[model samples]
Structure formats: C-alpha cells, structure tokens
Target: MAEFLLEALSEEIPARMQKRAAEEFSQIFTSELEKVGLAHEPANCFVTPRRIALNIDGLPLQQSTVVEERRGPRVDAPAAALDGFMRSNNISRDQIEERETKKGRFYFVKIETKGKLTKDVLPAIIETSLKKFAWPKSMRWGSNSFRWVRPLHSILAVFEAEVLHGELDLGHDKLVFTNMTRGHRCCGAEKISVDNFAGYQDQLRKARVIIDRNERKRLIQEEAKKLADAKKLRLREDEALLEEVAGLVEWPNILMGSIDEEFMEVPSEALISAMRSHQKYFSLETLDGSLAPYFITVSNMPSDSTRDATIVVGNAKVLRARLSDARFFWDQDLKSKLDERVLALSKINFFDKLGSLGDKSERLQKLVPTICEFIGLDNVNGAVKAARLAKADLSTMMVSEFPELQGVMGGYYASADGELPEVCRAISGHYAPLGPTDACPSEPLTITISIADKIDTLVGFFAINEKPTGSKDPFALRRAALGIIRTILENKLRIPLKQLISKSLDEYPHLTDSNELLDFINERLKVYLRASGVQPDLIAANFEAGKEDDLYRLIMRVKALEELLASDDGANL
Candidate 1:
C-alpha cells in the first residue's frame, strides 16, 4: 500500500465558497475511488483561498487479479465464428472447452485479467472526479469551455511519492499534470516541488503558505488575542467571521490598527457592522467592556514593523472611509426625532402583496392591544404606543444602509429622541429570538410588541396564501412562528392561538385563514417542543383533543400524558 496526494491550484476562491468546494471535491474523489474498487484509507482534505489538497493513505499498489469464464458460439457454428471467438480471447482451439447448454453444446474459455497498477488507474479517476466536481457558482476561464470556481492553473498528483502522468482535457486547452506547485501569490517562492503529503505541506509552509485552513484560523485567533492583550483589550469572538477570515488568506498576520476617536462616537454596532461586513476586520473591546478604539485585521504576508505599518495604515484608511459613511448616517439621523420617520414607512413597501410598512405599522398598533390580553389584562395603552413606532426605523437612512440594524438603530434613535425607555426597549427587541438560539425577550411590554409584530406578519402573509413550502420559506415565516412560540413559552404567557389568530385575521378584511395560520404556528410549536425533548406522539395526542390553543396548557397536558405513560398504571391502560 502507498499514499496518494493531489492538489489543484486555482485563483482566489471566494471565502464563503472555499470550504464547501474543498469538501464536495473531496467527496467526489472518494466516491470515484470506491467505484474503481480502490478501497483506500480515509482521505483528508485541506483548503485555502487558492488551493485544494487531498491526501489518501494505505491504498493498494494495484487491483486484485480476477478469473472468469467467457461464453462462445455453439459447437456447430461455422469455423469463421470459432476462429473469431478464439482470436478475441487470444486463445487457440486447445485452450477452448466444449460445454453442454440448454440450447446446445457451446465453446467456453477461462480468462484471467491482470490487475492494473494504482498509478496507472489514478489518472482516469482524477479526470473523472474533476469532470464530476461542482461549485456553487462556477465560471469559464479564458476560452476554456471547462469551468471552475476560478481559473484552473496547475494540478499536482503524486502516488507512492512518484509524479503521476495525467492531464485534464479542457475544451479549448489542456492541463498536463505535474509535481510542481506554487506558493503564496506575493510573499512566497514562485515554484515548489514535492513528493509526499508531508513534504508538500512542509515545502508550502516554508514558501509562506499554510495549506490547512484550521491552522490558519488558530494562528489568527492566538496572534490576534495576543495583540489585543498587549493593549489591555480583548478580541470580540465571532466564529463565523473567523472562518471567513481564515478562508481569505493563506498566511494570516494579525495586526491592530487605530480607530479615529471621531468615528468611534458612532454606534459600536454600526461601526462593527461596517468593519466586519465591508472589510472583514474584527473589533476589540476594553477591559471595562467598552468598545476599544482599535481593530484587528489579518494580513497575508509576514509581520515586519516597517512593512506591517504600511499595511495597517492602508487598512485603517479604508476603514475610516467606511466608518465615515456610518458616522454621517448617525449624525444626520439624530437631527429628527425617530417618530418623525414614521411617515417615511409609507414609501417603503413591506412586501409586494402585503401593503406598505406604514400599513403594517397601523396593523401592529391595532394588534398589540389584543395581544396584551394574554400577557397583561389591565390597560395596555403604553404597549400600543410602543407598537405604533415598532417599525419606524425601517425608513431611517442608517437602516437603509445597514438593514440588519433596523430595530437596533431604532432603539438608539428613540433614546436620543427622549422617548420612554419602555418604548425604546420594546421597539429594539421586537425582532428577538430570530433563530432557535437567539435570546427571547421576556419583558412584558417588549414581549407584547414582539408577539404582535410576528403575528401580524404571519396573518398577512397567510391571508394571501404565501405560506412557506417545504425547505423554502422565502419570507422567513417559519422563523416568525418560532419567535412567537419561543416568546409565549419562555415568558409563560397563556395565549390562545385560535382566538389570537382569529382576531388578527379580522385586521385583514375579507380574509379567513385563521385556521391555516394557527396550524402553522402549532407545527412550529411541535418542532420547538421536539427539540426540547418532548415526545411527538404525546404532543399530537393533546392536539387531537381539539381547539387546544393555549400553548402553555397544551404543553402541560402533553407532559402529564408523558408522565402517565411512564407509570405502570397508565402503561396498563
């Protein structure tokens, strides 16, 4: 048995596409190997921005030799036919045997085919795998009809530490295989030669390239934290961004840069969003948990004081430009009270089928009072007031630029406008628990507004028959349902889905989809409950009892059934 290594070097693949491409390409190759009876050891795949390397160990030198019988014409067949069969099998009449068959006597020959060497078979395997490989988005490079995520440059194929002979036929060009591979685009050597996987990795590292993305991520995190620690600050942890940044560089050099004090005055979220989204820079925080006036960026080159200073300065200049736009939106937005932006909501459509956001805002104002029934019975005029401005920030310039900060900026702007703290918190948190792990809002007023907003959205969309289909919730209606379920259950609020949904459907005249919307929410509840360790059968049993709209009570009944089922007396029944 020997090892095999194949590396395909290409132009920079988009950071988001790099890992998946490597994984899918690895799967294709592994499948091809199995199809050819090359049952090898597990394969390890490595990816960077510019290359994908695969290593397979303990593969056989060649396939196993096999013996089989081939049938020939009947004994009475013509001499020409018998001669043709003998020639095809490379045998003589003495080598042939006469066999009695149901039809008649026939001629047969025993054939032994030699196993092909693994090296000889691998080129065809590699070519077949490459042709079968797919990308999320691919492009044709130059005039070549064959496509890759980027340009297909060079291929490195080595088996048993020997360069394998192979080539991929591009429609307009051909890529001959070689043992040669290039390193980092700018800082590394132009060309490097290797024999085995270990030497390939070592040579690439010496040439200023890191073949493994996880190692690059680790180096980036450790070095970045050290840099922040030196300045009495710490790096903000974002695993997603770390993965992305790791994909953006072959060699990560962590460096810290200053943030202009004037730009720091902008909301940290806005500044952080600008840095992360536009430049992929990670933010730092001070010892007291305040936003630090510095950012960490990963460079693809070595960290030399003279040259590194130039890179940091260049990165800071770009960041300064991005933050300036964020700052301008902040400064300009605060000039008018957040309430003044409510009219602008009319100009922004919530959905093409659903009315404008202004119309939805009006619906929310009417919906919150009904929602206050389950959360709080007494006067809810204050929550209704908060609900009126829940979506006001959707029209703000800052939100237009950074749409992810819609509710967050609204909360900030509302505080600046001297709005009640209750209203600010309510508006800001109305979109909480966006996903399964997101924090669910517990404050009564905030919960009230959130439930109302989500319910209104669910009703309007369902009223128009725009419910989410399998694996495709274009409007994220499932998330909205999950949000509502999380809020009701987490807050221990007793909400009757049938009644609340019926009342919400009334807000949209001539629409009678209350049962449909309630069923959707109930399905989401089942999903949420199953994730929390509840039995699906018990939940369904409780639902089958009919009109079990109060989620809290329904859950209590299901748990009671589960406990009973666990008991001997109930088990007997």
Candidate 2:
C-alpha cells in the first residue's frame, strides 16, 4: 500500500473558482485511476486561492492482473479464417486450445494481461487528466496552447517516497513532474520539498499558507468574533462573505477598523452593502443590535503590529470612500418624492417586449386592488398605493448605484414622502419571500401587493411566451412562480390562483386565458409542497378533489386526508 499526493500550484485563481476546480481535479484523478483498475481508499481534495491539492491513501502498488478468454473460428473453418482469429488475439495456432461445443468443436485462447506498477501508470493518467480538466473559464499563457484558470507554475506529483517522473506536454512548454511545491507567495517563494501528504501540509503551513480552506474559514470566523467581542460588539453573520474571504487568503489576519461617524448616518444596509460588496469587509453591530461604527477586514498577510495597522488603515480608507458614495446617493435620492420618480420608470425597460417598468407598475396598481377585493381585504387603497410606488425607486440614484436596494429604498423614500406606514411597509415587503427560506409578508396590505406584483410578472411573461423552460429560465420565472407559491402557502391565503391569474391577465388586453399560467403555478406548488415534506400522492389526491386553485383550502384538505390515511381503516383502503 502507498499514498499519493498531487498539487497544481498557479497564480491566484478566482475565489469562486477554487472549490469547483479542486473537485474537478479530484474527480478526474480518481476516475482515471479507476479506468486502469487502480483501487484506492477514499480520496480528499483541498483548495486555496493559489492551488488545488489531492491526497489518496491505501492504493495498491500495482493493478491486479486480468485474465480474458477469447473465442476463435471453429475447428472446421477455413485456414484463412482460423489464421485471422489467431492473428486478432495475438496467439499462434499452438497457443489455441480446442473446445467442445454442442454444435461442434471450437478453438479458444486464454490471454493474461500483466499489470504495471502504480508509479509507472500514474504519470500518463495525471497528464491526461490535467489536459482534459474542465474550468468554467481558462486561459492559455506564455505561448502555450494548454489552458488553465491561470498560468500553471509547477506540478507536484508524489507516490509514497518517490516522485512520479515525467514531462507534461503543455503545448508550448513541458512541465517536469517533481515532489516540490512553493508556499505562500508573499511569505517566501522558496521551493519546499515533501515526502507525503502530511509533510506537504506541515511545510505549507509553516510557510504562512493554510492549504485547507475550511480551516482558513474557521480562523477568520473565530478571530473576527474575538475582535468584535473585545469591543463589546457582535459580528453580523454572513456565511457567503466568510466563504469568499476564506478563498481570498492563504493566511487570514483579522483586523478591526473604525467607520467614520458621518457615514454611520447612512442606512446600515447601505453601509454594510458598501463594505461587504466593495471592500469584502464584515460589519459589526453593537450589543444593542444597532450598527456599530466598526468593521472587520481579513488580510492575506500576517498580523504583525505594523502590518495590522497598515492593513486596517488602508481598508478603513477604502470603506470610507465607498460609504461616502453611498451617503451621497442616499441624500440625493431623498430630494424628490417616491411618486415623483414613478414617471421616470417609463425609460427603464422591464423586458424585451413587455414595455417599460412604468407599464408594469401601472398594471400592478390596477391588479392589486382586484387581488385585495378577492381576498376581502379592505386595505385596497394602501395596496394600490404601495404597488404604484414599489418600483418607483428603480429610478432613484441610490437604487441605480446599489441595484439590490430597489424595494428597500422605496420603503425609505415612501416613509420620507409621508405615505401611510402600511403602504410603505408593503412597498418594502413586496419582494419578500425571495427564496424558500426568506420570510413571507404577514401584513395584509403587504401580502396583497406582494402577490399582485409576482402574479403580474408571471402572467406578463407567460403571455409573451417568455415562460421558464427546463433549465433555461433567463427571466427567473421559476423563482417568481415559486415565490408566489411559498407566500400563499405560508400565509395560508385563501385566494384562488385561477381567478387571480385571470384578473391579472385581464389587465394585459393582449393576454388571454390563464390556463398555462395556472399549470405553471400548479407545478411550482407541487415543488413547494414536496420541499415542505408533503407526500406527492397526497398533494395529487387533494388536487384531484378539485378546488386546486384555492391553495390554502387544498393544503388543509391534504393535511386532513393525510391524517385520515394514517388511521388503520383508512390505510387499509
């Protein structure tokens, strides 16, 4: 038994690409080994910004020999046929054995294939795997036709105590395989030799590089928490930001930086967005859960006193510039009422043929009242007001700069414009339940407007024949449909989707029957129900009972039926 270690060190691969690349490297390597009948224990892959490494253990020194039986021409066949059979099997007439069959006697040959040493077969497999490795985006570098995510610097291929010696033809240049790798580029670019996986990891760590991404993530998280706690603040949890920052560094040095007090007046969301998106910094919140005037930045360098101060000051300066820009957008956007920006939406295209956002907003304003009437909600005025102003912020300078703040900015501007509080809340909540785990709107006005917004978009797109097909949902119609399903189901809304779709389609004179839209909604409902752990048959049985359009009622019936089926008599039926 032996161990194998392979590392491909390169220039910084994009943080988003590292994990995927490592998986590809491991999969390709193991698959190639499998094709050659080389069995091994479970393989592991590790990725950092600069490298993808793989470690395999308990691999046989050589593949097991295989025996194959080859049948040839019958004994009574012509000499040429017999000759051809012997030639094809690479066997002479003397090597062919006579076999008795029901029809007649035939000639058969036994062939034994000798297995090669693991070290002998691994070089070609590694090279072929490297050449065929897939990357989302790759580039050819330095006159080489071979492409990689970045310039390939070295190949470290070791099996047990010996290096797998070979030359990889990377088109313009050849990479000679060796058991040598370099550690953290900033620490020292000196060659580090290793005998096995453990040695490789230990040397890399000593050289200021943490080869395991999960470990790097843990270090960043723990250190950031400690730094925040020391200042009586808490770190705002951002798993996505943590994952990305982990990939951006080999050695993470967590440092706390101060935000300018003037910038704190900007909405915490805006400030946080500016810091996280632009500078990749994590915002800190005070003990009372308000935005603290502090942020945490993870540096790729060591945390020496001088270096820490320099990195912190530099990041703080960068964050200040971003927050200043955010503050400017915030102030400039408040200069006009949200309703005043409504007319400007005429210039912003909603889709290719669906007219401008102004057109959609108009439809929503009309459709929301119908939805409110159907649901027997008396807040028709508030729903209509919110629907009208929901997308008006799309024209605001703040939303233009931070497109993610569209509905959120509307809420702020609506409140500033002295709109009803319910209307403002609805305007902000219209885009809620963005995903399965996101919160659904509980306020009556907010729920009405939210459903109205999603329904209008779904019907408008389906009418234009732009509905999501398979995996090609360019317009995210599936997500829109799912959002509608989740909101209705979670809120236990009693509105019939069929009637609501009909009313929404009526707003668009060119659009006709809501059958297709109803089917799409039903499909999304089944998906939502299944995800919520409801049995498919139960959902089908409930739908089969009719009144499928009333989701809340259908769910109740499904639950009741599920309980009935759990009983002994009902189960027997």
Whole-model lDDT, candidate 2? 0.88
Give candidate 1's TM-score.
0.91
Candidate 2's displacement at residue 478, Å, is 1.2
Whole-model alpha-carbon lDDT for candidate 1: 0.89
Worst 10 residues of 1 by lDDT: 509-518
Estimate, for each residue in 1-573, the C-alpha lDDT of model 1 and write its tens digit. 999999999999899988888888899999988887788888999999999999999999998887889999999999999999999889988989999999999999999888899999999999899889988889997788897889989999999989899899878898998999998899785899899999999999988899999899999999999999999998999998999999999988999999999987788999999999999999999988889999999999977999999999999999999999999999999998888889988998888667898888888888888888777745487787788788888877898899999899999998898888988998899999788888999888899889888888898888888889889999899999999888887888898878788878887775666547877888888888889998778878988897667888887888899999999989999
- Residue 191, model 2: lDDT of 94
TM-score of each: 0.91, 0.97
Per-candidate Cα lDDT values, in order, are 0.89, 0.88
Q: Largest lDDT belongs to which candidate?
A: 1
Off by over 4 Å in 1: 66-114, 377-379, 544-547, 567-573
Given candidate 2, what's the lDDT at residue 425? 90
Which candidate has the highest TM-score of all?
2
Per-residue lDDT over 1-573 for candidate 2, one digit per residue giving the tens place of the 0 to 100 score: 999999888999999888878887888889999999999998999998899999999999988999999888889999999989977888877888999999799988899999999999999998999998989999998889999999999999999878998868889899999999998898857999998999999999999999999999999999999999899899999998998999999989999999989988788888888888889999899988999999999888877999889888888888878988999999998999899999999999998767899999999988887788767899777787888899999998888888888788899889989999988899888898787678988888998888888888888888888877678998778888888777777777788777788888888886675548887888788888898899989988877765478877877888899999999988899
